[model samples]
Target: MEHYHDRRLVEQTWGSSNAYTGSNYTDYPYFPTLAKQLLPNLRCVQVVEWAPMSDNVYNDGWDLKLKTPDGDGAATAAVASSQLADTSLDCMFVYFDAVDLAGHSSGFSPQNPSYMQALENVDVHVGTVLNALYARPNYANENWLILVITDHGGIGTGHGGITYEERHIWWIGSGSAVAKQQITGPDPGTYNLLGTGIFNQSGVDQAKLKQSPVQADIAVTALHHLIYETGINPETYPFWVGLDGKSWLSQFSGVDKDMERNNIKVFPNPTTGIVTAWFENPTNDHVTATMLDVSGKVVAQHNECSSTNKITLDVSGQPKGMYVLQIKIGEQLLTRKVELK
Candidate 1:
């Protein structure tokens, strides 16, 4: 997580128009976020949300919290670097809020000298934590999946708006599992971080991991990891109406072929009713098309036939928002963002 500012506050501070779809806040027992859903299932998950403004140490869920007297990125990183050698910890979530604070005080634009300095500071702290991880005794044998991500980016001096500078952010996953090449696709959103963690814990094959994971997908993936590692199964699980994200992961243990760009075309995006998908070349292999909403719920689906190269999908009845379109031709899959207007 980046700043503690909720969606509304960010929009109110930065939005120039009436319409806004900023990230939602963490609400428990109602509209729970990823951390709220995944923590209970995981054992000994460490969490440190430093920066005095967004201190989450008081929360009962965290196994460990670093109390920094200075409340800066250096102090937080020092604590994490010293404590990461503990082999007993299964999962950890470390959030450095210093960069965000720096942006708020100075400016968020990359041209801002202070902003660049703040990022450099973050890099140094991150290096310290990485050094600790590499120095671990079980580092060679451990299947570590290191992911670096931020909740959102700032625009101008602040954030929380729908602008590309604010909403569009990047995530880095480096380890024995991550692909060496650059992973490119539509904006996956911050909610996918939880699902990525669960996917890493699961030794599932990458070929099966089709679209990016959503909040609900994290819970389903965690369930799959539990079943894969330990034979224990929960009889009555949390009742979630959204999609079962785990179904997208492959059962085997290997990466799938990357999506062939320019092979699939979607027309009349931001569509009001009907949308058309055209495949570049006719193939005998079966092609499956699945549409998922922002909440990771399947709204529509279709399987392409050899009868024609063009596939038509109707989303007139669905609500107006962003949706993910996944086209799977055999083991290969490609994703697109569809806006229903």
Candidate 2:
């Protein structure tokens, strides 16, 4: 298992080996992506992550994989469409890798005839997948969140870098919970894409929603969705802390509410453990500190008597993930992000 895992690190990349080393990149220990992290642990969760044997979904606890021909979106669509009637399956992910290869080979432009043809083919392929989805026996009863996204866009004949042409992309989400109106002229970053999808599916109080400013905010949003869907409390495992993303949920919700008050401060954030949150004034009011996971589940709580202005929480033993620390002093509630690694 270890050897296969190591070999997959190289095979999964765009090229056979690293340009500099002429060998595979090091297989370092890292946290799983949101889809991989949440789906495997959930009971009856059906996932299909496509790749070779070394990078197979089943190896990571996912249920199935489509044996589509290499870079053949039509083949993938057919297989996925065929299985949509299976009532036992709960969730599905169908990826089309051919378009990416086509984009890289030819310039990724709407004007490019080849590129345009490639997109048209994908549209037809996706139509079939949608047809299968609607054909499902439980379609009328199920709440589905269908998301369409591209990793990145290209500039000229190449891609990468955060240029307007590169960073800018389109995302289309259609489902029962998505907003009917279109978002106009809003420049939401890529990190917010999945979170936006989740919000459209599983709602967060709009009054409490805060747009994230960092790329890592997607991780927090993913965790929030997982909790809402699975009803699993994340406090049992390690905590997750997005590297730079702001809290888009209640933590930010409370922060927005209490920002003007400037009553509390959480220092040594992204700490391994042993966090200290201190309040400025309110000498005679009772205070309470609640540590919550992204899903808003309370992991731990501490109560402080009237005279104390500071409360400490130890998160060393908790799993590594993102958490929200909400501090309530009398009437005001202040919240911040806590990363326990």
Highest lDDT: give the candidate number: 1
- Every model's TM-score: 0.49, 0.50
In lDDT terms, how accurate is model 2? 0.53
Model 1: worst 10 consecutive residues (lDDT sum): 230-239
Worst 10 residues of 2 by lDDT: 1-10
| Residue 85 Cα positional deviation in candidate 2, in Å, after optimal superposition | 2.1
TM-score of candidate 2 to 2 decimals: 0.50
Off by over 4 Å in 2: 1-60, 184-226, 229-238, 243-341
lDDT of each: 0.53, 0.53
Q: How do the residues 294-337 of candidate 2 rate in per-residue lDDT, one tens digit apiece?
A: 55567788888856878998777878988878777776556677
